[model samples]
Target: MSKEAQFSTDKFRLDGKVAIITGGASGLGFNYTKAMLISGAKVVIASYDEKGWDETSKFAKSVNGEVKFIKIDVTAKEAPDIIVNAALSKFQKIDILVNNAGMQRRNNSVPI
Candidate 1:
């Protein structure tokens, strides 16, 4: 069989993996968190929105996979290191990182 045809159920599993998803409190990042949790990976969601953190974390917990929410501003230079440190502190290692946080300035002069 070809390599593409060799995929198996086990190959699709994320058991024992740890993932970090920026902007995971909402939008597409949240979707990725859900998929990772369902696939058996522990996820650390980094976002600036505290409001969505509670709700999103609740859903992730209901899936029976470990999840942690850390408030972060991804625009900061230290943000990446902070995220990695947090994830490492919790899960000891990071196997996946989804850099999904982004900002767009409005009216050309609006602050990001």
Candidate 2:
């Protein structure tokens, strides 16, 4: 067998990979964090809301993986740089970034 095939499982693992996920403290972002952690990738969860951080922490503990939370709002002009710096500070290098921060609200005054 070829070397590639021999280490297929190793290739699937994210042993030395780091991922940055925006709005990862809650909702779909939270789910993504769990998945990546289970896959062996260290994750940095960036969010403006600190409330959901507790949940993320608990999940991280249960999964026994490395996860960190950084406060950020993607709407701001400096948000990109802030996020990049945060990732670098924590993980040294960022291998993945999930731009999942967003909002959805219904205008009750408008008729459907």
Write down the worst ten-residue block by lDDT for model 1: 2-11
Q: Per-residue CA lDDT of candidate 1, range 16-65, in tens? A: 99999988878788778778887899999888877677767787779787
Compute each candidate's TM-score over C-alphas. Answer: 0.81, 0.78
Local distance difference test scores for all models: 0.83, 0.82
All candidates: CA RMSD (Å): 6.6, 7.9
RMSD of 1: 6.6
Q: What tens digits encode model 2's per-residue C-alpha lDDT throughout 20-100?
A: 998887888887787787778899987889978887888788868888887877778998898889889988999998988
Clashing pairs in 2: none
TM-score of 1: 0.81
* Candidate 1 residue 22 C-alpha distance from true site, Å: 0.2
